[model samples]
Target: MKKATMTKMHPRCNEHGHTVPIKQPSKASLAQAWADPQGIATAVPDSAMPETINDVPVSAWQGAPTDAAGWEALVAGLSFTEPPVPSAPGKKPAAGVVTIEPDGRVWVVAPTNAFGGYRHTFPKGKLDGLSPRASAIKEAFEESGLQVELTGYLCDSVRSTSVTRYYTARRIGGSPAAMGWESQVVMLVPISELRGITSHPNDAPILKALPAKAIVIYEWGLASGHRVLDTLAGHFTRYGEWPTRIAIPTGMHEGLREEILSPYGWRLLTERLKVVATDAGALCAYGARGQEHSYDTNGPVDLRKRASEWIWNVDLT
Candidate 1:
């Protein structure tokens, strides 16, 4: 049998019998050394390593000291601070809530000291020992001073190091004046406008997912009212754009026509209207013909009739 050529590995110690691996500069030590001009002396030169090993320098290693105290001092001089940010092992789970009110307004609070310049967001906090739903409700009350009932689940997300569960809630009682120290002020904003005020972009989608319903004032006898409403619903179904509030004359007349046509292009002169008319005669003519035409049953005619006998509310919101 042919004798095999054996490659000899270098021993842990150098020719001077000094420990080699023990003196290697840690990442923190290397960073500190780079900051100090004298650290260039301690850094291993690229030429120190053999030409075979990817031409990479054995940068971290250094010659060990002779005296025991000197070795201890060199080891002490090394640092380990440059590791990744440490997270607490086995951190507890957390929960938060998105609270809404009965009037299509959502509850949000401004923290006393906001993060990333975010002043307005839905109430959220760490979960204690309670269930996620219970914790969410508790957080809502504690942060906004409102007692809320958990309606349904909103979403769950990993925020920072904690996995937080979110729930949808509705205010039942209490007032913003009773808010605890955690929040500066509690605000109730219309759901449509919630995204504009909230500083956190992540919270905007939750507010957007809520149903969009408008309170439109329309007289049952007016064919123009039905025409406008049916067209609006069709537009929403096709494009997913909806109006949160709509206003129409309780009964059309010369005054109403003048108001609608007042430099606003008859108000319905926009793309939403099938036909644009400036005067009452033209508007009434459209309405008279509108009654004879067939419309989609899926469109909200019955819903509109059910909500009919409408009162004139001064405030559309």
Candidate 2:
């Protein structure tokens, strides 16, 4: 089978002032561009692309060898560790891909109306003698009709029949209109709506594994600290986890260290929490209960406004 060609290349300048082809758009830039109607043209599309190149599926027709040694060689440079949650006993190993488009939308597959108890989910299947990376690539094409290149490991989620390792990927070629018989439809969904659309109980861990687009940072106070903590706790209870990203002032870190790190499993929260040093004048003193305060620094102000979702500050005097 003939291999599918990669998407058209665009030129970009590097630090050394040499012009080089930019392989993929950064997630941040994609998110920003998605907001503008003109930016829709910037997104990669499969307009003239073929569903299959020769007899093989376009997604799996990479020019590289499909053997075990070949797959191992391809992933040798990638750095990823096993997830903290171990595979379930007596379950098989599987792999999946979460393909994000250039316009910042995520690809999800509808499994022929709840097939295998899945209404909508990421494309995935058993390893079937292939490496996790290879299996994920093949499964993505068969289930979602998208050729994906794995960028990074997201996490491993233990499901009813398998311990599936999920990876973050970007669409490189192929078209969703060519989805296989297993899938009824393929959809590109916004990140904010992913949690609501892919609402299977087993998918909670996978959803949590996705990186947050923005984090909320606030000053801590004797009275307001507890209120913020209560708000965070409530969010956790409703969402099944704390915000993926959080930041606090350095001075307050010591005072709230145990409360923030102990009960929720330090291993999980440590990576998400950031203790930053703030200038004395950067933050205003707390005002009235349930009141909001704005940041004095332009950086924080810009971050709050630019974030796609979830940004707020609480202050009390």
Candidate 3:
């Protein structure tokens, strides 16, 4: 029963029934375990893929899988992609919102009602069951009232009856005084003008559940605003992204110079890593979106002079 009470074990029974024990879960559970999606689309195993992304025609990889474990299981199933392909058989879970402004235009929405006063759409909806990733974040703040923050996941189409999901939120907080009532005809289109708007011919189920190219990766068990010393319980790793350290930022390093980046799963393959930041800014995440950072390290020391305070390396094959 040592090791600092062993992070807290669990197994209970009590009342003389002989088994008592409980009290440790201070927090951190999130919980999720209920997938079925028609047995993951028939678990297609036949491989020989390469159907696109620079010469993949030949009628587009018929039964994909030519070798290397069926092309690394068709590139790890397109780099771990799944969910949203159920547009027909009993569909429901909906929610949309690509919203990417700052002069980038990616807020395509569809679905209107009124004609002269309210007839626009695309800040979609229809998810309350709880998790189409939390209903694409409550249907993008209930159809563009604002209040967004997801920063990831922009797929899930499901074809026919309606499976939507398309998220990539950003706004940050409710605005336009907080919209609702189906967003009174929301607008905001750009991803290349969204083909002249008024879409929804079923918008090709969010452009065939988008994903032709996008990839980025890098992460390390983080959370050290400054006085870090959790005893390296997680001992996070992946440290080599783009080396050549500290030419700046000192003390609690003004807050881990954030610039999160996630492309993981499409951009084919890329790497240019080199990290070393502490004093609270020592993280240079990538894929799961944590882009580039340098926590100006000043403690956990040891890595050489700059104590690894800065110096990452990644050649990405």
Candidate 4:
């Protein structure tokens, strides 16, 4: 019998800058890793990573740290000027990226010695004459050594010194071993463990904006008038979070629609309803006469067309 040969893997660094062999995780192991509180942590090359790249300080934000007092002082000082000309009144515009892997793990960076009061945080920096999207892409690569493609805008975070725009992204290429000096260590954390790892108040809103295992609710008139509210309330009660997306019928009363969803902070979408309806893993449809059909299949374009009423897509792991 012939034996299968395993491919040799590359060595990466740990938090202490010690070189260690790392192997690619299997699907089963990746799922297990996501559940485990101690997610994957890898360190970048300390000696190789440069302190300054292209005349920009690798440790970037030299203003106050992210503490409450520091943040207040930073904001107050912005109103005053040194050379008789005051700087911009508001926070500096910055951009960052939050990269998530296919297996549902988030990539975070550990700033060197908790610089700018961030021990573990997402990669972000000042715009530096670049657009928000472009700056986010640049910062993600520079801090984590990972090439990422921006998928959607996440949220705008008002930090101690900057108002940073964050974008959701997926990893394309690159390795953590190539991370710049700004990040002492690179970590691949699960969404569940994100809050625990990052304790700064500035990161709370960004974490809240992250997508979760949600049931996208779609309703016309029947479900909207009867079961939609119950379904949304039940989901919120059970999971402590609202559904990802909700689609309403064309003729539903505008005031009623707003009253039902606005209180829960669900943004109603009319123009992009079809686009949201099609991009789901599973869907449940409600007929015009209250007939119902639930589907646990992917790519349900045909089912969507045949259904007379609204459709709900539940993300199946």
Candidate 5:
């Protein structure tokens, strides 16, 4: 030690060529460490909760303890309602048209040589490089061989591939016989007969929304009388509207029922509800066929009451 004196190493390199020692990093507080790791939490510590709680003195809760721990415990015990979540992503749009005659007959299409033509549906198609309105117009032409002008947006319904947007339209030209290959037969069906004839349940709402005169024909003797009413009422309430006609017992009134069932009535009643009487003579005389159905009256009174609610709400001007 006397022969050679050693100097302490400096933190920084010296001009004299002495070795420099590496400096160690300072340790941070637990909170600071947590904050540093998480980019969100702040390193700045919050003061501990107040020893005394600033209680809101209401008549019902005035006598509650004001200790901070007790207040925290109370708050912990309280429940909160979660916010509502947004609707799921919407399905792609399928544009289509709903054509209705002045007499409340809706145009529908039957698939040719398919399923024995047992199912009838509205003329609608997927949007293929056309605007919604344009697509609807095109679909009407292609499926029903009819030219139409869109009147208004009717409603939205779900399909196998996407959601369908239906637009109300009036026929301007074209013949149903010339319908495209997609449809075997295209024709006008009465609004009241729609739900029964249409294979797709979704189309019922469109029919219900159409304006039409209702005929309620019933017979006390028929076991299906009440059932028919119940089914019709269910269809009406579900679709937000009522049928064009209903059949009740003949004895409910004295005069000839056929006398009141006029052409204007037939245009309105020309086609009886498929759920009602299936007399071939009556259907043919009215220029239609007997309805094929299986629906029976479940609760005629309750169903009628619900249908009445919708009827009362309708704007019948």
Candidate 6:
């Protein structure tokens, strides 16, 4: 067939004495190879593979590495590694608690080695490997000499889940003589007088997170019919970005089955969601205006809602 002649690859992909079919080149194909830095045309000098200017080698696209390790290595060689931080930081070993009494009073424990003067403020303490509540109980007993039960979710503060549950525990047992390392004295005061008390740097965080919830709940009830029996989360409106919430009802969202979610700016929000499990199965329902939503750290509870999309997360157990 007076076909067009061709030049050899010089070194075939096979190590020795082997020849594969000679492939023809196309104009559109040639444009792509010329655009690639790793393509055969770029590797060969002008003296060789003159025809490669016309097409990508079949090998160029074939038998690509089955794994990413090779690509990762190539990227590593071309990229710079950021130097590590010179100073390694330490993480706090455990969590602490602040228990206030029912008469709006908290027994502040004084630190044993006060940096400058005698220090005293609510019964606060740290948790070991045991449950947080259990540790709080032990510390309160040891520090303030009082045994009690934890009642409510006071607030969540800090970046690393330093969630301290403030309990309104009745003094079930013990006395004021008990003490621990860095802890010596304990006394009580009304919640209305919380801010007036002297505080340590760490104490400030707990106080800030302390919920003025009694008032917020009262306001929610006055404004809307939804009487907030408890607050599951807090909302602030300092900036102008009003948060939009979409109620996610648990079922299963089938593999991003629709493109509509993005256009609507759908986001999974933790603030207003409630997880409800029942005889039927586990379901996720979010707070609706008609339905009450609370994020009390006591955790979200599914009360009820209307006209909200109820989808399921199949991975949910």
The clash count of every prediction, one per candidate, is: 0, 3, 61, 0, 16, 17
Ranking, TM-score, top scorer first: 2, 4, 1, 5, 6, 3
Arranged by lDDT with the best first, the candidates are: 2, 4, 5, 1, 3, 6
Q: Tell me the lDDT of model 6 at 290.
A: 38
Candidate 2 structure quality by residue, lDDT tens digits, 104-162: 45778777536778768999989888878878877887777676677666678888789
> RMSD of each candidate?
25.6, 15.0, 24.8, 15.6, 31.7, 30.6
Model 3 misplaced regions, further than 4 Å: 1-94, 97-123, 126-144, 147-150, 154-161, 172-176, 183-257, 261-317
Model 1 residue 98 lDDT score: 75
Which digits, one per residue and each the tens of the lDDT, describe model 1 over residues 6-43?
Answer: 53221233336653332222111232322221122111
Top lDDT prediction, candidate number: 2
By summed lDDT, the worst window of 10 consecutive residues in model 5 runs over 37-46
Where model 6 places Cα greater than 4 Å from the true spot, the runs are 1-89, 115-118, 124-126, 156-168, 211-225, 228-317
After superposition, candidate 4 runs with Cα above 4 Å error:
1-38, 46-88, 212-317
Which scores better on TM-score, 1 or 2?
2
Task: Note the Cα lDDT for every prediction shown.
Answer: 0.44, 0.53, 0.36, 0.52, 0.46, 0.34
Candidate 6 per-residue lDDT, tens place, 165-204, comes to 3433445444443333334334444444556664555456
What tens digits encode model 3's per-residue C-alpha lDDT throughout 187-246? Answer: 344344455554545555454333221111222223432122111111223343322322
Give residue 77's error in model 6 in angstroms: 55
Give me the candidate number with maximum TM-score: 2
Model 5 alpha-carbon drift over 4 Å, by segment: 1-90, 115-118, 211-317
My TM-score estimates for the predictions, one after another, are 0.41, 0.49, 0.23, 0.48, 0.40, 0.36
- Colliding residue pairs in candidate 1: none
* Cα-based lDDT at residue 62, candidate 1: 27
Tens digit of per-residue lDDT, candidate 5, span 218-268: 112233323444555554544444555444433421222343222233333
lDDT (Cα, 0-100) at 284 in candidate 3:
29
